[model samples]
Target: MSHEIRTPLTSVKGAIELLTDERYFKNNDQQSKLLTIAHANTERLLTLIGDILDFSKLDSGSLPMHFERQRIESVVTQAAQNLRTLIEERNIALEVLMANDLPDLMIDPNRIAQVVTNLISNALKFSPSNAQLRITVENWQGMVRVGVRDHGEGIAAENLPKLFKKFTQIDSTSTRRAGGTGLGLVICKGIVEQHGGQMSVESAPGEGSTFYFTLPAAPAGAPSTTAEASA
Candidate 1:
């Protein structure tokens, strides 16, 4: 991730340097457009770095979790909203279907949001334009299951088992086409596990894919704590 950020940072600096030159200023239109692209790439680099740092903290058991009862629907809604622009840009149909009776469970809202965002972002990347991404939350046997379904080029059978491995890209060529550091799902898995959740993916080639995770329901009359919850 650090290496990935440096490329964009270097590009942005170069673009800025050119923009500062008097000759470049005379042809500012094209230069300005390049600067815009550079700015966007810089933001992407920063986001990737943040994800890496968060994942590192999680792995080292240094990440802090503020556990409190939070409405599941609200968390899902917020995550979907965060990715609205990406969804629109791809012309994909993004839907959130939340069960009205979902219980307020103790969790770190930000971490949960990160999980949702990662899953949604991955879905958008692999999915065809105009395909649908469905996010659904439901209560099942005292646990909340959130599933992200994408109608994309589904994972190959040989690659399914390696999906969560850090820096392991199932489709190496597709990584460049998809435009990500490939650590997104690894980070999502670490976050969900820290929150006492189990994440799993179900997919077959050409059949689309669904990634679902389950978080245990808060025990009856039990107070929430920062201590890790068991999956």
Candidate 2:
């Protein structure tokens, strides 16, 4: 389905790109504005398509699970670093807090990284400029808990239950403004569940929000993937 839909979407995007080119539209102010709008919507369409593909994999249980021994501190730091450009562009402070002796987690590093990146990205999107965005890792009741906190316009009490639902939009006006497929949190929750973890959010209308998840730490003498593959 994506293949068929993307072909036409690509054609539309290509035309918009050419029309919006500054060199070509230099003297056509009205045309340039229209083309710019088209270009932005096209980009949003492409993102939506990508999100659909991800959600399909997740829903079908086809998303591959790669269990690895991942250091809690390093994984989230790298995820945040991967998004450093976005954070810096928005002028937000990015902080990662973890104890020096935190234990490694038994999980898929890449998928976990995706969750971290998504949470931080969402936080950055809603947060005010110059606000502090924090990613903290701590040991909680024998599990490793990671939280992404953002000082943004918090969600309402009634909307909490719909957060992880597929294609959920808390506010249509806000959705149109933000331009997301809304499958991100659903995919994040699916990944965490596949790893036997739990994902949740905490927020109030006036205060900020925190999205956090917990995963079991790798047990002592657990066979590492590298060694298992070799054997």
Candidate 3:
């Protein structure tokens, strides 16, 4: 994990060093583009590092849970907002559908948001530029299910079983094209399980894919609130 992180940090530092050189800035457009790519990759690397560290803490039973009532809609919205740039850049049609009667759930909002963001990012990575990605939230028999659906190149049947394995990618070509460190889904699964929830995926070749997870619902008949929380 440290090596994975340092790779991007080193690249970012190199980019910065180049930008500081007066001669390098002479080609403004090229330098700016290089810097942008380096900066974005650096951010992605940082996020991956955080997820790995969080997973480690959870595995060691050292991660603390902060449970509080939170609006599911808000958490979903936050995740969407974080990826708004990518969605817009790719011209992907993004939608969020929430049931009118959805109830507040107790969870670590930051961690849940991370799971949502990872799933959405994965969807975007596999999908075509103009494909549609939909996020749906609903109450299901005393549980809350959040679904991230993508009209993308679906995963092969043989690869489904290994989807959540750490450092596992669907295939080498896909991993190379998508530029992932292969720990995103693994971390997502860990986070969901830590919240007493279940994460899963459904897909078919030539069709779309939907990644869904179910979290325990707030206590029966508990009062609902719209306050935002981190997940």
Q: Which candidate is the best by lDDT?
A: 2
Worst 10 residues of 3 by lDDT: 222-231
Q: TM-score: which candidate is best?
A: 1
Candidate 3: TM-score? 0.82
Q: Write the number of the candidate with greater lDDT, choosing between 2 and 3.
A: 2
Model 2 CA deviation exceeding 4 Å by range: 1-43, 172-175, 226-231
Q: Write the per-residue lDDT of candidate 2 for residues 56-135, one digit (tens) a residue.
A: 98887677777887787878888898889988998998877886667877888878888988899889888888999988
Worst 10 residues of 2 by lDDT: 222-231
lDDT scores in order? 0.80, 0.83, 0.80
Clashes of each: 0, 0, 7
Tens digit of lDDT per residue, candidate 3, span 118-198? Answer: 899889988889989999999877789999999987877888989888777776454578876567787788778877899
In candidate 1, what are the lDDT values of residues 80-115, reduced to their tens digit? 998888889999988888888887687888889888
Candidate 1: clashing pairs of residues: none
